[model samples]
Target: MFRLFGFDVRVQSGFVVFMVLIVALYGSEFGWWLAGAIAVLTLLHELGHAFAARSAGADAEISLGFLAGYASYRPTRPISRARQAWISFAGPFVHISVSVAVLLAMGVNPLSRDSFDDSPASFAIWWAGPAIGLMNLIPVLPLDGGHIVNTALDRVLPGRADKPMIYFSIAATAGGAIWMFLNGYQGFGIFIAFLIIAQLQLLNATKPRPSPASPWELAGRALDADKPAKARRLLTAALSHPQPIPPTSNLSMTPARANELIDLLPDPYPHGDAGNEYVLANLLMMTGRFDAAAHYAAGSFDRHPNTLSATIVARAAAALGDHSTAIGWLRSGADAGTSDSGLAMTIDRAPELTGVRHHPDVIAIRRSLATPG
Candidate 1:
């Protein structure tokens, strides 16, 4: 792996193996040049996407593997549909442009070439770019063109685009395979037939998927496997995720054990999310860290001011004998729940709030929550 234009480029074993196979099959020096040319062009193709993704505020890693290359990117934030389409188009755009330029410089007019009149090198290079690039523009899933089409479909139909794209890809692949076979391109036809089967699998897979587990979940697994050190590392990593989406609750470990693992960490903990703060606040409360729990809960409430955060803050404050603080938080929670039908103030019945449940201000907030709208 190396860095180019600020993006990491990883040449996988499969990439090298495939290129080596090409050389062995041809049994000549020309095969070496041909493989080298394809690798360069494919790198350039993936670079287009990497650069485009960078411009869109994403970090992209280009991985050259079997068959072709892929640019996997993680956007700093949600990318707009139009930007996604443009990013998908970028790879093929660079591919076609560079291929045409090379062909023209080699004294072969790509636009005028209906048949292959050029040398094997030019023919192979052309196929790598203009031909494959154009093919990639076809609206099929897992391909550049397919992604572009999927983005457009999503823009127009919202969340209802995946099934349509998969269905269309199946139809297109099936039809293209038939056309290839009819035109005496048996190899390409067979490839397209395989694509049809892949698309059918994709069609069947168009359903809701659970969110991937966060580092916290992994930490619990590490502990379960009797790897306390690994659990500690994962727990720390979870706190420092650039963009964390922690699970609603951890089932991997009990609150007491999780808190103990966290306490083992070295000081000056990593920056974290409100999700982490709220969850940690509860864990702190469970482990009898009332003051620390109040601090974390209050910090979370101040950042996002959600009912959940407010409830935790109130509970912590009540446990700490700060009834005034508890009452203030309960009021804020109730006020913020106007849209949720007083969900915030409905916490009067919570067992954790029993210490301050009879406080006048707390009771008033609960009365409002209990009032018929």
Candidate 2:
């Protein structure tokens, strides 16, 4: 891959075979010049998508493969339907535009074609130009038209657009194949029919996942698979819901095991929802990363003050030798009538707090917890 216009542009290994096949089939009619033109124009078609995607603040890459090319894009954040539509349409739009411009210039200056009036340039132009433009407009998944249709339907159906897009594509593909057969393009018609059937099979295979997975199911599956980071992400997302599903109470998971799963999350964890922040704080604390744990706990506490979050901040503070801050957090929790004996016990046994366990403030905290709420 090589960078072009701040985007990676690469041609797949199979593209060499594609060029060889094209040369073998049409080299006599259009000669080597026409073959080179097809390759260049196809690259330009993919570049159109890259250009439009970048214009919309997305990281874009262009790739040319056997028989086709595509532009891959990843936006920094969610993009609007209008921008998506533009990006999807740009490739065909550029292909057709370039073809028309070249055709028009040739028409005005007949001398431009004096060298080879009988060359296959005309045939190559039609095939690589308008033909390719029309083929990509077919409404199928992984195609530009499919993207356009899906985005447009999102505004109308909101969340249930997949079924409609699949149905419409099937109908369109069937009609297109029939028209091709009737027009004596039997070979192309059969190819289109086969493509349509494959797409339909894929739709059937993935029909069950009509929407995103539920947080509990995803989290549970992650835990089962021993992917603690993924589970942590889902749990955090669950907690962010307007009415979060209580992980401990709503799910059939044991609290001890769940906490242990949280401890398995790797260090430098990706920051996420408040609940995940609290979990990360606990993980860091367990790993003897007192400073980072205190930072995360404090941030989580600032966002959503709760008994658990307060205890984390307090425990992390105590581990870091901040006796006053640690005692103050427990005092605040007690003042709010939110003290938990489990939290006090956990803090009292923390190995990092051994140095300050006999401090005056620590003694008072122990006395205060012993006195009860």
Candidate 3:
């Protein structure tokens, strides 16, 4: 790892292996000067992305690998789609610009060509920048062009564009690899195969699983953002889901905020009472409405008996200054073999529960949590 332009740049071991292989395969045409030039260009291209991201007020880190480099940007919060698109395009823009400059120099300066006559440096000057730039422009997932495509699609389609773009990357890479092999560019063909594999891994990683964010959860987000209309829309959508939707343990909003969100939902909802009630209970407790939260929670618990509902009820009762009820919930959960470590930790760390932390019953619950069933 090294720091360049205040960005942490990590060069993976595969990068050195690639450089060595390049030298070994075409050492006669790939001298030290040419190799250094390619390396410098790669770093500069990545820097373009890093600097662009930082300019956009996003924190950026870069990683350079054998065949490619990546720059990751994490904004303090979400950034505008246009700003994201600019950051994605920045690297290729810098790379292609350098390539053009090199070409123009070679065209005008007679000595520039003659000085490196018959050397690998000549090949580097002609091909390195342009090749890297063009390859990066191929629309493949995890690639700069792929990112550009996704960014554009996201602007138009929002959440519906990612999978299709990834599929496109897969098909494009496969076709490119086959074409490269048929045209005697075996090295390039193999590289595309590697890229194909990488894309496949990414696809697997992003495969749709059960997301924690139900309509109620999304509504909570909308309410937090002071957009009750959006929250209402989300809740309406949540009401449409098939019955017996499982409770989510991933509630992120506090009780106070959750109640505000619940209050915003329009009446005459179309939800299955069990799941919606449990979710509502969680929201209530998060906003410090412990008494009402406990009422909703008890009903949800009688029907569901899951770790999530139990945790919500226990935490709510404790925050309402009722350590005994909290202890009872914890004890019953443990006895029934439904309690979870994550739920226990949530209760343990809650600021509202700080008053009960050293209480004997709370310590007993903590001990129960530490012991395996």
Candidate 4:
């Protein structure tokens, strides 16, 4: 059990204890007033998401977490890519707005000061808000900025958002670690190392386990050789019973490139191919074909019930005005160990769906997803 915004909130044991420790040690030094101010800022950051989601006619819930706080919301209907982008950016936007407001207020006050050495309380007010805002903006998994990047990448690249996001996270984390080391911040460096290790573990776990050539890949190879009948047979097999590819000969291309090649096939399976299905669904969703995207996502899940397919299905369901369905699928995938931090972060931000949000599996999967891949 946790408390925030004068509300009793339930959070995972890990985060609940972490927040408790933070409050215990720092609460006195910062003073109750300053500590409460920090809490309010965190809540407001989440509320930014809540308000934006509400504006889109979505349902949202705000909650406290281990070290921070979040809002969970699912849109009542499919929204435009632009709208999605806005929603993704809204949390940070709120944080920044609050920071700006504080700065403006400070500027207007004759006695307002910025030096932490002078008064820890004033320093807490001045820096805590912006620091929290900036931290949320970090483009790492489970962060608001990470969501912005992932959604944008989905919009731009369609079939492959994971690789870029993972790669970017690695680079950013590594760089942060290096900066901390160089600055002689041993404690911070250790913390960053832990974060890196966590992220890496997540990356390895969520990585598509190596498998034999998927039917889609076989179909692509056949199409490349102009073997139409063989291609059709493979596509049929994929549609009928999509199994994890068995370990086989290495493909010359990266998975993303292979997926692109598969997408180029003249008579590709409409929804059975996971990669193609994801791309198609996102395209449809982007174009406001919520029903069509939902259909394709269902087909994708039927073929391969992994993180990507689950996300598509959930998003599609949300677009189709079925928040319950969306939450169900999201929770199911999370339970099945589909640890995609971006997906978990999405769930973390929407808490009104308490059954799903409070499920122990949800945080486990999310933590797994955030581990570096």
Candidate 5:
């Protein structure tokens, strides 16, 4: 691991192996230069992503790995879709630009070139930059272009964009691989096969599975199905599952992104709950069932009374036109063993809780949570 351009870079063993293999296969000046160009251009590609990500108020790390390099990043907050697409495009953009500049320096017109010279440096630049970069822009999974398409789909479809993109990536990669082999580009074909495998992995992650008969899982399914009654029932029925359930696979929304914590707790936050009553109540409130949500939110407070639940109940009450109930719960929440300041801030931040925000209990807790500076 090393740092470059203010970004952490980890060169994977596979990357080293790839370089050595390529050099041995060609065994000439072109081979050595090819290896060199891949290393430099791949790093530059990732750096393009890194620079753009940081400009968008994110921290990034570059990992140079097997067939490609990636820039993983975490934004201080959610990033806009346009900015995200730009970040993906930036990598390939840098590569193509460098190729163009090199062509200009060599007194070659990029458009009119019948064939690029096979001189060591020229061959390396052509192969690594324009060739690889243009390929990366292919609208398939595990490529920069694919990521651009994914970002656009996210804007148009939001949570529903995964399967479509994954399926398209799989199909396109398979077809491209077949064409590459048929047309005597076996090397490129093998690379596409690798990309197809990546798409399959993604497909598996997003694939739905039959979970054990846990109320939390059931509640989640019910929410997905838009069955509010089922959701409320499952939430109320939450008991620990008899057997441990496997963690659900993560569906990757964006490519090559890693996140870091602002603060670390002694342990990781729990991944599941028996019934997830708080979530159900919150869902109910969101779906305009304030009465049921307010009534059910008490179950969460009963099980694990905390600022989160208190805020939920108080806000639901306020939504139901019961300002007195809202105020009463807010006071009780302020007295609860959790952070008074957190409760105060919660109420203050919720637009629905405007009715209770000015209550004396809320005021006191907000003042308590406040910093002098």
Candidate 6:
């Protein structure tokens, strides 16, 4: 736990160490004043995001790093691509505004001019602001620019955002590294290479596991199970191929067979089977097939009761005129205590559980849910 600008912040161990190293090195090379200034600037940059998120009625948390900061907010509502793009651009917007203001002051005022001269503090502020802003604007995965690119691509191409953002990050990082090396910025070059490597590892880490069954096979298995009819229907909708599969009893019927069925499903969700359930549940809800929606939503909750799925189930149950069931599911979510602002917003907006808004458990649930997406 940490505190900055009257707000509580949390820092991971690695992040704490990174911040300490940055402060120590900068303070040693320049002075405590310069280090402190940079810290303040970083905080302000992140605060811009926090402010924007809060304005959007989202829960926000700030995380500070050695050379970076982020304001994470829960995305309770469906944010359009343009909104997402603006949110991504907001932090740099603040930094750039400050930079321009400072530069102008220095030019206009004699006192400010002296500060901008040979002093390390002036130099750090002048360079760091633009540098940090531009760095974050780089179209790479895990950066603000990457997010902007993702949002833009999402608007134009829909499903193609993530891959392109990743590819762009890789290409840009590589190009930046080469440019840095040629410009005699060996330290910067090494840093860029390290960043690219880290991003590569992240990409590999998030890669989906290969599935054994096709969707149709999984649907058949679900049908064979002694589940409720509604559950079977939901599962069938979820597991069905976009294109019709030829009906046949000769297909294998084991769990392995179910795996084969999923493999046959076309254009499966990027997050794999778990994501498939989410898409299926939402699709049912959108179609106003409340019973089927409830079934898949419940299935989603059972298999992966993350905030997103849980909230969906809760809402679906409410919409199905099962207020008790919706409230119960929401209470269960309150107990799970997830930390996603988006989920929190969803839960908060649930019609069935409005009475519990001020309850301690619900409030705590809200706090956890406040974390940015």
Off by over 4 Å in 2: 31-34, 108-118, 138-142, 189-194, 197-373
Candidate 3, which ten residues in sequence have the lowest lDDT sum?
108-117
Superposed Cα deviation of residue 342, candidate 4 (Å): 37
Predicted candidate 2 versus true structure: per-residue lDDT over 1-373, tens digit per residue: 8888888988798887878876786557574555676788888888899899888989999888876687999998788899989999999899877875775565622225452244467556756676667777776755678878898998999988877777777777778778887898886854585568766885796567554444555776887898878877665555454434333312344555555555544554445465446555665666667787777777666767666677767777877778788778766655544545755664577666676667786677667675343
In terms of TM-score, which candidate is stronger, 3 or 4? Answer: 3
Q: Which lDDT value does model 4 have at 270?
A: 49
- lDDT string for model 4 (15-117, tens) is 5465456568676766553566666677677777777777787777777665667677777887676766677678878876786577556552313453432
Q: Is candidate 1 or candidate 3 better by lDDT?
A: 1
Question: Number of clashing pairs, model 4?
Answer: 18
Instruction: Give the TM-score (vs. native) of candidate 1.
Output: 0.61
Q: Is candidate 1 or candidate 5 better by TM-score?
A: 1
Poorest stretch of ten by lDDT in candidate 2:
242-251
For every model shown, the clashing-pair count is 0, 0, 6, 18, 0, 21
User: Candidate 1 lDDT, tens digit per residue, 185-239?
Assistant: 8967545755776677787788668878766677777777988898778766665
TM-score attained by model 6: 0.51
Error of 1 at 330 (Å): 11
Name every residue pair that clashes in candidate 1. Answer: none
Q: Which ten-residue region of model 4 has the weakest summed lDDT?
A: 108-117
Question: Residue 313 of candidate 2: its Cα lDDT?
Answer: 72
Alpha carbon deviation, residue 322, candidate 2 (Å): 18
Task: Summarize candidate 6's per-residue lDDT along 220-268 as a digit string, tens digits.
Answer: 5555674445344545564443324323323434444444333333443
User: Candidate 5: minimum summed lDDT over ten consecutive residues — where?
Assistant: 257-266
Model 3's number of clashes is 6
How big is the positional error of residue 199 in model 4, measured in Å on the Cα after superposition? 3.2
Better of 1 and 2 by lDDT: 1
Q: Which stretches of candidate 5 lie over 4 Å from their true place?
A: 108-115, 208-336, 339-373
